[model samples]
Target chain A: MTRTSDRERRRDPARIALYVFLLASAAFFLLPVVVVVLNSLKTMDEIRQGSLLALPASPTFDFWRIAWSSACSGIECRGISPGLFNSIKIAVPAVFLSVLVGALNGYALSQWKRPAADRIMLAITFGLFVPYQCMMYPTIVLARTGGLFGTYPGIVLIHVVYGIPYTTLLFRNFYAGLPDELTKAARIEGASFLQTFGHVMLPLSVNMLVVVGVLQFTGIWNDYFLGFIFAGNENAPMTVQLNNLVNNTRGEVAINVNMAATILTALPTLLVYLLSGRYFVRGIAAGAVKG
Target chain B: MTRSKAPARGLSDMPESGFRPDLVAIGFFLVVALVFYGSLLWTGYLSLTNSRLIPSYEIVGFDQFARLVATPRWRTACVNLVILGAFGIAGSLALGTLLAILLDRDVRAEGLLRSIFLHPLALSLVITGLAWRWLLDPVTGIQSVLRGLGWSSFHLDWLADPDTAIYALVVASIWRSSGLVMIIMLAGLRGVDTDIWKAIRLEGIPLWRAYAQIVLPSLKLTIASCIILLMADVVRSYDLVIALTKGGPGFSTDLPAKFAVDHFFGRANIGLASAASVVILGFVASLLVPYLLIQRKGRA
Candidate 1:
């Protein structure tokens, strides 16, 4: 204790430097966000005249309102409002379906004792690494042929297909870690596989479910590429609309509106992160380490 | 005795009820195989054909691959990917590890600092690119701000210049990803047994040497995971390029993913786009196969 106090009392240059470095890095990370928020709050004239890093002289929510309702994204000037609802519509169902399918697949794979199960698991895991571009063209062709392309259900299916690998991996690993005795005990109770899963495994999977659900929600919500290619114009997510609004070369460039739209697009995932950060971190760590 | 007999009976009877689960598993496997592997094969086949704006069944052998190689835009995209991968991976890993180490020292406001660092990861790459683009925009952004502060010589027009636009991407991606790496590394650091630190302290080994020779080496898997994740991010980096540079100033920032999507949809050259996609898959496979094998070996 005395030594610890002595160490704390000493002004270690190295420690001070370390703190400074960390703080600087934190500032660097926060710089873009701060700039965007300040610009979002400022008027266009203020943005044009003032420094990008400066606080707004008279911050207002007007840009946010415009970005949410009136700012032009592309051909239409409906702002990101349509895209916001589209995203929620897409994300909620996608998350629920993917989580359900993943849980079932994971539970089944974990319980199965066959060597073929391992091979199937390996294949599914490999799907996690395959670039979406490789599959984009064919999936488009397939979707078009099936008359599902450019539809809401089409987008949801795409999300589910892509999401299955990740969600399955998470749940599979989680279930695999459970003691085998649980399954054996359930079997002894004359529970069928589905019944065992419904009665025992799922009830025990609230934590994993939240982790997977939160991860999927944020992932699908933040997705721009998938949403761009798969969601079509009417079903485009907020990210796509936000990009269109900012990059629309027509008319006067409203930097404030663009920044506001960017913030608005980012808000859902940011809120998810802030609210369930523990689960988010857990999901990321699990994904990285396990993958 | 009855309970023990019942356990054996349960084991014997399990397969009767297991049929449905097995069927479910197989159904999913078939779907994955059909969609994932089927798409890969389809793309590979398409790459070999002369499909343009439509599916052409006539195989031109390796002609599309040759064209893909010959195309300067495609070549630029490939090279840009390498540059982004090399710099982005190394920068994020180094910076993230440093932040992780700093945070591991039980610093005050660690959670606050961590959240600040990590908040970026929650954002879409579009938002990240736009925010950075705004900050790096010369006329109205950092350069003008710095000049207004009397720096006078501040000039950062990287986004506009073809030669430096890729570096701007590298910067944004590193900023967006390093926080994730930091959290992963911090987890790894926390998992390190305290006994190792105790021994190091007992030996009076220098802290840097301890980390260099001892601590990081033990976290090889953690480091490998970080590299894999970052590499994947670099390879499939389309949103950032589109949002930031738009492959602008004559396609300087185009990634292969962007290249493929453009050729397929924008340029209406299906064969070339499919070729690009195949090349990307090959790149991913090259990285993933070895990692998968290593993981299998580790498990064994």
Candidate 2:
């Protein structure tokens, strides 16, 4: 007992050092977020006069109000409200359509033993790595030709198209893991392809759907490049609007308002992460490992 | 639950009379082909032309490619991509692995610490950049804050200095991405066989040596996955640059993706942008094809 206690005493300093290091690293990760949040609450005067690390002397929601409703993003005095609506409008349909199509495609690919399935899967995997810039010009031309460029449907379609690789991957891997007897049973019941998917497969995919949907929602909401290119001035998403608002160099910079807008723009994904932490981590792991 | 009630069908027994699911898969395949492959071919063709403002499609015999190499900014962008990829991948992987190992120990508040580390991954890169940019701004950010705290000689203006600005980008990116690497590595660590730990303990192996020699080598696939993912992020990085520095202090922080976008939209040099895009595609393909081949071989 004395020997073991002596060994434990010897190890105490190392254990303390490990905890110290972990805590410091955690602080490093949290610092930027803490600063952003603290500054977002401070008045411009307080921000300029005081240190960034200090607590706000006089906290207010005025900057958030301005960022949400009235701060100028580019030429428009209207703030991120319009863009917020546009993001929701775009993300809802895009997530639904991408997830739905992915479910269908994944179900088909996994259950069917067709010769083309592997090749198609290979193509989709290739799609995952192809930089968006590579496909941007042609997609622009295609969207313009289809009269879909700068329109709501156009942006949604683009998200779905780009999102296909990830969503299909998640669902395909998931469906592949289930017992083969599930699909066999569905087929034996004389269910049509759509029927089997709707009644048998999709019902079983609620957890995966949540995972994929949450991921897609976060991605679509946080997207700036796609929205900048495709959403046009009238239909720009919150991310694009936030950039315009913060980066606009014409007027005096509103640092507080920028921080406020930054927080607001990040709120949805943050909320999703907070609520669905388990699914989010799982989705990320699944997506990363497979991809 | 009812799976046992139905007769098990052979793997080859695809239902024939129903609506064809294969057709749906085929349709998706066509869309992927038209959007992905068709774009690739078209971009490649455009790179050989002298199209400007609009795609002229005159086939100027590699003029755009020649011009792309001649552009100094393109050179800078290419060099910066290498720097970002090398530093960003290495930094994130190292930090992530450290955190993973640290967390692998039975620490209290593991969930809270993991959440803190991983929360940044949930936020957009734009948000990540803006937050970092604010903190790193010398006049109004951490420098000033530190000065206010009586550290009068403190200085951090990397965002504004062209020479050191790319390192600022690297720092912000590592900050944003290392969490992801940590999570991935942590998962890999969890999967390490318990017997290995027991064997190491029995042998009285130093923990660091055990990890470095035995555990890490066994996690080759996990490390490879992390590298590939980080490389993909490096190639596709645009939002972070735009949000943080906007390739600022005279295009010092320019990356290939930003270079392509600027030429295509801001400069209206479609042909040149297409060449740059093709180069980016080539970079991705070079990385991906070999990886894919190896993955296929492994599977086989």
Candidate 3:
């Protein structure tokens, strides 16, 4: 309190007003999560009373357990665990392959600098802007033709293909910011492209790698549309199952269980964001500003 | 720039063999290029033909487009796209800029507040949709809560009402995206010249006037990029709608993306879906061309 200057004390009214505004907006942002989590803890009867924001009269983890294990989907009573496993399988490989390809593409662009590369880069990046709907028909056809349809590999390939543009943009901007002297010095030592990349560039790019990894992990995990379309029934991701559970339309509504499922499904990405909050911000800045 | 010059003058810059390409890099490029261009050409071909449940390559020359235009559902979807796009863009921009400006004054716990605001970006649109759907559901959500507080006339059932469903989509989307807009704008604000602030203070300029006349113009590039990004989000919007309204209450909130998906999957009308997709690409390309060109120029 002693750090406050006389001038700052004079502006206390304005400062307090701004704080009120900001805090209200923050509450607004968190309201849905609060409501969802609170209701998810309640029994079905409590939720049926129709006051979602109410503190549950009797909070329990029943719905959470049910959502994780035995919530009904069609005939079977399998919960979202299968979809969770499927999502992990899809996200891990997709993130690894996409980030790897992006690094290579970025390294080539920044270091190799072919005459037509810039134009080609621009066109490929343009692929990011295309709606998946436009590409869906052909992609499904291609997957079928290649015998990858309704398989994990098919979904992973789509994620990798689509993930490249933004990752390439991020890594390209990153590598572009680095000094070329290192690469030139390595080359003068008779080092080849792979050697220069392995010894010099890759070591320098550890920070960007973390940033890209976080972004890709969050993205690939949260994706529902691609996983819904490509991953087929047995391999459907958590989101698709969550959607089925919550938005089934025909089943008896289980609001608490649905809420619990939503929370459970979103946990992985939410945890990622919370843990790597700073790198997440950096990733967004790099992707949006550069891409 | 210095790095480019150093590399250009080096002996290593010379081709080992005249005009040799990096085969590995080119191979990656070719695969990506094939997917992108291949999809574009294939989708275009599908659109022009009489394709139905499967590909019928016999060209039918815009019959699908005609059917698409004539369909009332498609028309509703297009209208919803316009309404949703306009509001989502404008609402997120205004809210994001306001938050950014407020944040610029150097409040306490700024980092924590920022993280709270932006944490939504990490969540999937499905999560956003489901959470908002519960909050907006009249029987189960805020409306009932309001009534429980003895405000009997409360009617926040936008999620179930056909006419107002699109607005719910806009509200949820703005919630999901305003944080991103805030971060981008904050970055833009930080880039403002300190001398400009000092000049404004010396002249005793009002805060709003300084931001409106001076600060905003300087952030034209940032604002443009934000708008373009927001537009792209609008075109690509799918998971949100799927999880939220499901284009329900008589298809009033139906978007073009949802329309394409329904036609492609649920309705099994591949030609019509492809046509919708191509139209979406047109809108996206119009927005992206200038953006990509400006970005390239900025880098140069």
Candidate 4:
């Protein structure tokens, strides 16, 4: 073929436009984030004075310091640090219980293949589809009636119940790919259900356990609704303060504080993600491959 | 406490201590099933009644559903969800495919760019809404900044505008979900055979044409799965909307999941809420049934 003339090249303007369109689309995707970072480094006066694209003359660290140590969330002056502990308190136990339960259920269903296992799994799978909002009223009612309302135990148990499906689904499919021969051999030697699982299965599931742990941790820690509902005033998680800071922003709306609070609220979870991203990718890939 | 005895957790599951196969375990699973299904049954019953703050024994008999149907907010939510869902799924898929294709081109620093895009995935995506809220809110955000900067003509306040708030949510959700879509499509693209590309190029097909004709059509299964996942996600989307707008500017951005939540929590109208939830569940089941049945029929 002959080399294309300038007219022919120019005739493909739509193709060039596609590139521009895509670049604009990508920019759209990043716009809010760009606004966040830009506003973060701006002084309050500068933020109040101009376009988000404008740079601050003297960008101050003051907003971040206030957000971390002193930004008021309700009527209180203390920041979200206490709520951070509360999230850990709720999330850690919740993760432990849910993962243990989900793993046990997954192992039993997949390996044991008990009668009605398929139906049972289907029903639970359906449970995952149930709008969590639908369950919220009942959960709150149950919590209140059980005298567990606005308590740590209530929040933890709520997380466990809601979390059962995600963890169980991941592990069930994962354990399905495990070698059945090991469990079979253990059973043939008269090893019982608990022993076979404890010895033959659990040791081989370290990577899976970490993945499950990270997922549950993210879900629970990131949660705002359950935390808001059940944690009450004293036990509210970091997101609660994070919410109030953004929503109210003291008397006037403080853009810098909002960004700082967001960064602070997201820090722990982000740190976990950065540290665990490799393992998480590997785990999900392994699970998907097995499926 | 009495049952806490260390009698036997052994592999053999000795008969005396109630092994895994014992009736106790069976009873345990039954209890779990009962509790799981029991609440749902109760919810269904509540939907048929006039329960508000507390559950009443009175049966109102589909009144809530009727009311829910006539409610303007419900209609808006349903419509808003469709719009948001369509834009979100299409936008994410397009971005994901483009990113995957570009990254697959033996590009340098592909991992770094991929990670930057996917880093948003790492953080709890609740922040997506919050971050966007900061960017879009009229008073403290970009629009205000632009106004102060002598570009007083700038008008971009989607988060607070009743008409455009849903699109704001769409933007945030697409940001949060694009990485997952990219990963999925990348996997699909990598699975394509290179021989076809070589063959197509030899036949004078441009790379773009080859991708469109060969690679794109082959990605149908991935696209289908992504669509289904996105549908379910939109149906279940509560947190981001709740964080950003709280279904406000007078419920313009209200989604069904949020509708169900506000009734269930803030409003304390369980009967109305449960009825709405049942409607959603029914819609899901209907969609699922046709596919599964048609698939079964096709197989048969």
* Candidate with best lDDT: 1
DockQ, every prediction: 0.62, 0.60, 0.60, 0.34
lDDT of 2 at B30: 87
Candidate 4 lDDT score at position B283? 56
DockQ score, prediction 3:
0.60
Q: What order do you get sorting by TM-score, best first?
A: 1, 3, 2, 4
Interface RMSD values for the candidates, listed in order? 3.4, 3.2, 2.4, 6.2
> For each candidate, how many residue pairs have backbone atoms clashing (under 3 Å)?
0, 0, 0, 4
Best model number under DockQ: 1
User: What order do you get sorting by lDDT, best first?
Assistant: 1, 2, 3, 4
Residue B60 accuracy (lDDT) in model 4: 74
Q: What residue runs in model 2 are displaced by over 4 Å at the alpha carbon?
A: A1-11, B1-15, B297-300
lDDT of 2 by residue, A75-180 (tens): 7888778988998999999999999988898888776565467778878988888888877998899999999999889999999999888888889888878887
Interface RMSD of 2: 3.2
Question: Each candidate's root-mean-square deviation in Å?
Answer: 2.9, 3.1, 2.3, 6.3
Model 4 segments more than 4 A misplaced = A1-34, A282-291, B1-35, B144-154, B194-204, B286-300
| Residue A247 local lDDT, model 1 | 81
Cα lDDT, model 2, residue A64: 94
lDDT of 1 by residue, A30-148 (tens): 89988889889999898888898888998899999999999986679998889899999999999999998999999898877667888899899989888897788899888989988
DockQ of 1: 0.62
Candidate order, DockQ descending = 1, 3, 2, 4
